[model samples]
Structure formats: C-alpha cells, structure tokens
Target: MADRVLVTGGTGKTGRLVADGLVWRGIDARSATRRPFSADQVRFDWADDTTHDAALDGVSSVYLVAPTDRIDHLAAMRPFLERAVARVPGRLVLLSASSLDRNGPMMGEVHGWLDAHTSRWTVLRPSWFMQNLTTQHLPSILEDGCIYSATADGRVPFIDAADIAAVAVAALCDLVPPSGDHVLTGPEAMSYDEVASAITEVIGRPVRHCRLTTRELAARYTAFGLPEDYATTLALMDETIATGAEDRTTGEVERMTGRPATTLASFLTGQRAVLGSAGF
Candidate 1:
C-alpha cells in the first residue's frame, strides 16, 4: 500500500490543492480539518489533541501549515508536531514564507523552528501567492474597480499556489529525502500597480491600484471586522511588501517540478472572471 500522508489545513487553498495533487498521483493522502470534513478522509483538528492520533495513524508524510498572525506560533504548534513526529516517523513538509529569512515577525517564528527541527523534512518558503490577488483579494478590487493596499513601490515575485502544491507532492514522494528550504517564486517580480495592469490587460477593465499608509490599511482591515492584532499583522505584511522584500524569483519550483513557474499575467488570465466579479 502507498504510504499515507496527512495534510493539516487541508481545506485551505494551498492545502486542498496539494492534497488533490497527491491524490492525482495515486498517493494515499488524507485531509485534516477543524471539524469533520465531508471528504473521504480522517477528520482532525489542531485545537483538539484527541483527533491527532487517528489522523496520524499509518501516515508516512505530513504537510504542515501553522496558524497565522501569531509571533510565537512555534509553541502552539509544538505539541501537535511533537506528537506527529514521534508517532508517524515520516517526512514533514512545512509550509513557510520566503520573508522569514529577513526576520519577518510572524512567519519567522515558524520558519526558525522548522529549520532547526531535526527530522526528515522539507520547508516550502514561497513568496506571496498569486492566488491572493485572484481568489481572495480581487473581489474587493473588482467591486470598486480599484484595489486598496499599503504596498507602494515593493516588487514581489508572486508565486502560483498550484506550483507550491506540485513541489509538495515531489517532496512527499521522492526517495532521496527532502532537505533544506525551497524558496519558490514566479518567473518575475512585479509591483501591485504592475499586477493591476496585468489584470486590466487580461480582463479588459480599468482596475486602479491605490497605496495606503500602514495605519490606514489597519483601519480598513478593522472596518472589515478582523481582530486588532491580526489587522496589525496584515498591515505589517503590507509594510514588508512596501520594503521590496519579495522582489526576487527562484528556480526551486522548476528544479523540483521541471517547469517554469506561472506568471502573474497567466494567473490573472485564468482568474479574470473572478477578478471581474464583485462577490465570491
């Protein structure tokens, strides 16, 4: 039988895609969600330790995604991870951020711990996801025909989540064992304004990009009903964006997947309808 792989945050965007990719390759993959997910897999929750054993049972690999916006997330994730490592004795592929190398607050904690953890593991430190612009944030932009953010002159090699998933699949199945962090990015770097222009070119709509102050961005997030700390963290991420931290591409995805990473224009073209829509 194929070795079972457990996926944390499996219902999430990247996690779901990674799980699907594993399944497509005829690998035994299971998704772990907060509550009982409807898919034909074991239900698990990080908040509840009782669910861990059943999920990790017979699993030879795990795709780990820590909770966001927590600077000390390593402690919170430690219990679950310790249990999984001790019990499963398999590969652990952690989903981390590329910005962690520069001491970015929240992601850095997870990055630090994962790097030091002595086990068979692979860390996927991907740049800002192209999906964020299309799947999550584009609705608001499309509604007003303008996207508001704090990023000003920052350029980021926004990566495709599908590419990240593909890399995860390779890491999980490869026999040589996964090692070191894989910093993945798209083919090129582009600023938010450039990203907006790409959307306009694909959708044939005049989409405007607006740069806001960090405080203003925090206020906007607060108005959207997110908690204060989370809002501040998001604003800080935007500030990091404004600093041009993510303005670089890497060959990690191509090295693993044997294909060039998808471009922003290509991603926008595939997601033009969603970008044109006002609601999800």
Candidate 2:
C-alpha cells in the first residue's frame, strides 16, 4: 500500500495545497483539520490530544503546521509532536518561516526538536507567501486600496504557497528525505512598493503601500483582534525584514521540485480578479 500522509492544517493556505498535490501524485493524503471539511479529512487539533490518534491512524508520513494563536506555540505542539514521532513511521515535514532561525523562536524550537528527534525529517522555511496579498492583506487592500507594513523598502522573495506545497510533497515522498531545513524563496526579491505597483498594474486600480512604524503596525494588528503580544511579534518580523534579512532569493524550489519558482507578477496576474473584486 502507498504511504498515508497526515496533513495538519489541511484546510489552511499551504497545507490544503500540499494535500491536493499529494493526491495528484497518486499518494494517499489525509487532511487533518480541526473540523473535517470532507469525509476524507480527519479532525485534528494541536491543543486537543483527543483528535491525535484518529488523525495519525494508518498514517506513515506527516505534514506539520503549527497553531497560529499563540507565540509560545511549541508548548502547545510538543505533546502532539511527541506522539507523532513515536507513532508515525515515515518522514515528517514541518512548515516554518525563513525569517525564523532553527532553534530560535516560535517554530524554530519545533525545528530544533525535529532535528534532534526525527531520523527522517525535512523543515521547509519559506519566505513570505505571495498569497498574503490575495488572502491575509487583501481585506485592507480592497477596502482602502493600500498595503500596510512595517517593512519599509524591504525586499522579499515572496514565494507562492503552491511552490511551498510542491516542495513539501517532494520531501514527504522522497525515498531518502532531506534531513535539514530548506530555505525556499522565489526567483527575485520584491518590496511592498513593487508588490503594490504590480497589483495596481494588473488590476488597473490605484493601489499603494502604506509604510508604518513597528508600533503602528502592531497597534493595527491589535485593533484587528489579534492578541497584543502576537501582534507585536508580527510587527517585529516585518521590522526584521526591513533590516534586509529577507532580501535574497534561493533555488531550493526548483532544485527540489524541478521547476522554477513562481514569479510575483505571474501570481498577481492570476489573482487579478480577486484583487479587482469588491468581495474577496
């Protein structure tokens, strides 16, 4: 029988695509969401231990997506991960961020733990997702025709979540899974200003990037109902980008998936309808 892969956060941005890609590759992909979206998706929550066994049942490989509600996410995830490593036989792939160093903070702690514990594991540390413009930041963009950020003039190789998913599929399916972390990025680095211009050109709308101080950005996130500390941490991430930490490109996407990374322009062109729509 083909390996059964458990995809945590299967309804989420990248995890959904990962599950789809695995299915397309003729792999048995089981989506593990908090609520089952389909009969195929198993209910799994990192904070809830009750859902773990059913999700892990008959599953060989696992795709790990950390819960986003808390900054100290490692604490919440530790129990489930311990169970996963103890139970699952195939490789484990973790979804982490490029800005976060291994063994540093948040998902980094998970990264460190995976390295020390799992014999077959791969950590995907991808740069900012281009989907952010279409999903996370789309609300403000549609309502105000502006992109807000603390990363002043910072350039990011904004990768498509699709590319990240492809890489994850490769890691999960490979006979010999890559053991270390992979820093995935797009073909080129682009600033928020350039991203705004691209969206404006694609949608024929007057969109602009509104640069804000870290404190202002944090306050904006807090206003949007995010916890104060989580909001502040997000703002700090942008501030880190502003310091030129994320202003580089990598070929890991092509190396792993045998295809060039998706360009921001192509992503924006494909998302033009969403960008121009009144309801996103």
Candidate 3:
C-alpha cells in the first residue's frame, strides 16, 4: 500500500485518473500540479526545482508524467527525479510512450536512469491514446470531414488513457514495486484510413484520411505552434509508424489491471454523444 503517492501532472489525462483511483482505493494521493485548483494538490513543475522537495515530502510513491513542451524529457526531469528518489526512497512509475523503448531516447533515457538509480520503478509505454481522435483530431474533423496524417497505411493499436491509468494506479499502489517497463497497447490495430472509416460508421458521417508526406505534416505541426525541432520529431515518428513501427498490440494493460482493455468501437460508442454533438 502506498503511504502517500504524489501524482505529477495531476490534472492531465492519465494522472487525473491515477489520482482518483488511488484515492478511491483509500491511499493518500497528493496531486502535484503547478496550477492548483483544489485540495490535496501540491505545486510541482519539472522546470522549477524549488517545488520538487515539497512535492516529494512524505510521498512513498510517484507517478511521473513528463512535461510536453520539451523533446529532451530526461534533461528536464532528471534533477527532480533524482531528488525525489533520494528523499523518498519509494516506488516511481513513469508514463512514457510505446514509441520510445527503454534507453532509446527522451523518456527512454529516464527509464534507463530509473533502472540504474533505483530498484523500485515501473515504466508504462502506452501507445497513442484513443482519446486523440476525440480531442486532437476533432478540430480537423470539424473543419473538414478528414483525418490528416503522414503515416501512410500504418496501423496502430491505440490504447485508451483510462486503461493506462488503471495499470498506473495498480503499480503506484502495489506494496511490492515492479522493476521494469510494460509496453501497452489496445487489442486491435487499425490504420488511419480505417480509423476515419470507424469514426464515420460510429457517428454516421463520412470522413476520409488525408495523407501527407512527413515533411508536410511537420510543417502543419509547426504552423499550429509546435517548436520546429519537436514538430519534425513528431512527424518523423509518423514516418516510423508508416514503416509499421506502431503496428502491434500487447496484453500489458489487461495483464496489469486484470481487465480487458477497452476497444476502439466501445470507446467511440461511449463518446457518441460528443461526436454527434459536433454535427458529425
């Protein structure tokens, strides 16, 4: 049982759910956020080392959600993580991406750091979120009945953020800490074209996949206000996906949480009202 778990990015997609789950299970969950809007939330910023110790205070476990603004996640997070582990002597569960394998880059380096620095750690490498279609792609869908991607027919088994959180909650609450990474994914893999078709079927609206070259996609991301380097990196990931990098599924979610991961169809059904409300 976690004496006190500090969930960084408490208001974020997975962090919020992880915090709620921990609290529901009767563990003390300290939600760490730079913008504190409620009780039990402590100020925490990866850029602000001054806020680190306070967030780590009395915490027996940590749920680390890296900052999104930077590509060099290890440089931004390592100091706080080191301080956190040194002070708390507890388990640390990091939220990473399935695209980033252990010791590869970014969150991968953080995973390696955890492996070398502590015995109590868990790394969650979840695939793209199913919610991305409802949020990130929603604007594009609303603007035009199309989903744009640089990935040409690449299949991805996008996992729900809820499933990721379920596994994270279990990891954070476990008395016996897990020692390695879990590569998580949904049960089925589908391409961007198939995704558009699925959305069309679910919402009763026609939608198409608009394919682009990686360079074009990177330009699109830059136009939308991402750093050029980061945008290029993200677009390059899509190129990698095109080569079938994200084409597989894994049982990590169900294996960890003792429940089958949610399917894309079920997730879409649950979000039908939202999808339809947008005049789909």
Best candidate (score: lDDT): 2
The C-alpha stretches of model 2 lying farther than 4 A from their native spots are: none
Q: Which ten residues in a row have the lowest lDDT in candidate 2?
A: 172-181
Sorting all predicted structures by lDDT, with the top scorer first, yields: 2, 3, 1
Cα-based RMSD of the predictions, in order? 2.3, 1.6, 1.2
**Pairwise lDDT winner, candidates 1 and 3:** 3
Model 3 CA deviation exceeding 4 Å by range: 175-177
lDDT of each residue in 1-280, candidate 3, tens digit only = 7889999989989989999999899999999998887779998889999999888889998999999888899899999988987887678999999999888878888999899888889999999999998888888876788888999999999999999999999898773248988889999999999988988898998889999999999999999999999999899989989999999999888778889999999999898877666654
Model 3 — TM-score against the truth?
A: 0.97
Query: In candidate 1, which residue pairs get closer than 3 Å at backbone N, Cα or C atoms, i.e. clash?
Result: none
As a TM-score, model 1 comes out at: 0.92
Poorest stretch of ten by lDDT in candidate 1? 102-111
TM-score of every model versus the real structure: 0.92, 0.97, 0.97
Candidate 1 C-alpha lDDT tens digits along 57-122: 888888998875354667667778878767776678888888776234555665566556655777
lDDT score of residue 120 within candidate 2: 75
